[model samples]
Target: MKAAGFGYHRPETMAELLTLLADLPDARIIAGGQSLMPMMNFRVAMPQHLVDIEKIDGLDSINLRDGTLQIGAMVRQADALASPVIKKNCPVLADAIAYIGHQQTRNRGTVGGSLCHLDPASEIPLVCALLDAQLYIASRRGTRMMNFRDFADAPLTTSLAEDEILTRIDLPICDPDTRHGFGEYARRSGDFAVVAVATHLRFAGETITEARMAFAGLGAIQARADRLEMFATSQKLSPALIDKLAQEAAQMPAESDLHHDADYKRHLAACLLREVLERILRHG
Candidate 1:
């Protein structure tokens, strides 16, 4: 299907962009258009006005300040993946982005676009959730900062109002002591995962001090393995404990889908989590 006819406006400045959004109530912000374009092509999105922000300057830089990694709204996934700063500060993010899509898609996909799209199976939102990132939003009313968790509402849905524009994403610097791992059960190299696991383990001597786990492709929103994290924290990993964790993960509930049954996804989640946990523990 072809996209419905729409009016396009490319603003050269943030001030002009804000004025457009204020005037056009049904306007949609277009950055990389990797996600939105598809929706429009399928006729799922029929916005009458597209306010493109690509011509606007100052929304494409990466910076580090006060122990946080601040990425602009227009930063491409490919550019972010190759950034030395991202690699050094948050290897887990780089690791996850490698699984996103093909190189071409990454080259055109923007960080703000990915987060706003909020696909439950996407790697970007999973990383943002695990790292506790903040999203900076702007509107004619004013600017406000929101936590990523608060920004995500449901599958393919977010809390961003139609008139609000995502301006920046701020991710906390990964602690040097934090050992990270990411694993997913994808049918192919570039496909979305059937089950995804992301973890951060901090060790104090031989004991596990902090264990944070985030999972995707199991629900409407990326979920945290609260049961698993709570059980693993402050607990030394043993053969028996590992076995128990795997069993528990396999039994965790997930919604049934048309292709895979709930039980099958749960099983994959168990396998992926155990594999990543073991890998991170062995290496770190």
Candidate 2:
């Protein structure tokens, strides 16, 4: 299938881009176009106008400041995956990005594109959720920031207004002692995950001081394993405790799709969570 006819406008300045957005009806922002192009080709999206921001400056850099990692929304996945700032400050994010489609896709995919696409099983949003990242949005009105959890509304949807553009993503740095782990199950090397787990833990001697656990491919949006985190915090992990956490993961909300059933996904989640937890214990 081919995309329906549409007008394309490339704007070199944000002010110009915003004006186009305000003036054009049924306009869509095009960055990376890794996800949107396919949707348009399949006729799932037929926007009357496409505002390309690729020529705009200052939306592709990676920086670290004041204990936060700031990434421009237009930062290419490949650039991000190889960025020293990202690798040094947030290595777990790099680990997750390694699971994204492939070298070719990563070369063209943008951080903002992945976040806006918000695929249920995409690795990018899952990491953002686990890190409690902040999303900065801009428009002619002004700029506003929101938590990543709030930015995500549902599968393939976000809280972004039609006229608003995502500008940057801010992620807080974890404590020096934190140990991170990530695991996922996909049908093939480059396919989307069926179940993915991400976790980080800080231990004081032998007991956990801080812990975070989140899952993707379990429901409409990525979800944090709150019950498990609560249960594990301030407690030393034992065989019994690990077993209990796995059981709790099995009970998380899961939705069935054509390829996998709810029960199967739940089982995968339990296994993957246990594997990641065990890896952290053994290595850290």
Candidate 3:
């Protein structure tokens, strides 16, 4: 099926993009067009206009400023994966991007598009939630920052207003003591995960001072298992403790889709959680 008829506009400046968005409130903003194009091809989305933001200057750069990693909304997944600042400051994010589609798709998929699409199986949303990343949005009213948990509302839905555009992603730089790990289960390479988990730990000597765990493919939105995260901290890292937390994490709500049953997803969650935790403990 062909995409429904729509006017296409490529804006080279942020001001132009904002004007286009505000004037055409129903227009869809295209970054990499990775997710939107497919949806359009499937006739799932029929926007009257496509305001392409890729031509906008400075939206594709990755920079670190004032101890925060600022990623432009139009930054490609491949570029982000290869960013030295990202690799050093947030290895887990790099690892997560490595699992997104393949090299070609990663080269064209923008981080802002992925987060805005809000697919439950997407790695970016889960990582964003795990790291407490802030999304910067622009609208006629002005710019505003929203946390990942609040920005993403459900699969294929976000809190972004019709005239708003996602401009950047702000991630706090990881401290020296921070340890990160990521894991995912997919039927094939480059396919969306049946379940994905991202975890971070801050340790003082041998004790875990802080910890966070977020899971995708479990609910209407990517979610952090705060209950299990709190339990894992302060406890000595051991196979036994890892197994216990994994088991507890399995109790979290999981969505059942055509590909897998609820029980299987729950089992995968426990297994992957343990795997990630063990790896972090060994390396930390």
Q: Give TM-scores for every candidate, taking all chains together and pairing residue i with residue i.
A: 0.96, 0.97, 0.97
Best lDDT goes to which candidate?
2
Worst 10 residues of 3 by lDDT: 17-26
**For candidate 2, lDDT tens digit of each residue in 177-204?**
8888889999999899999999988888
Clashing pairs in 1: none
What are the lDDT figures for the candidates, one per model? 0.87, 0.91, 0.89
Error of 3 at 182 (Å): 0.4
State, as a TM-score between 0 and 1, how close model 2 is to the true structure: 0.97
The stretch of ten residues in a row with the least summed lDDT in candidate 2 is 172-181
lDDT of 3 by residue, 1-284 (tens): 78999999998878888888889857998888888889999999999999988778888889989999999988999999999989998788899999999988889999888999889999998889998999999987899999988898778889998989888999988888888889999999999999999998888887888888999888878888989988978977788889889889878888799989888898999999899888877876
Q: Write the per-residue lDDT of candidate 1 for residues 1-284, one digit (tens) a residue.
A: 68899999999988889889989968888888988998999989999999889899989899999999999989999999999998888888889989988899999998889898889899989988887789999999999999988999999888988778999999988887788889988889989888898888788876779878888888888867789888889987665666777898898879877788889999998898889878866776
* Candidates arranged by lDDT, highest first: 2, 3, 1
Going through the candidates in the order shown, the clash numbers are 0, 0, 0
Q: Tell me which of candidates 2 and 3 scores higher on lDDT.
A: 2
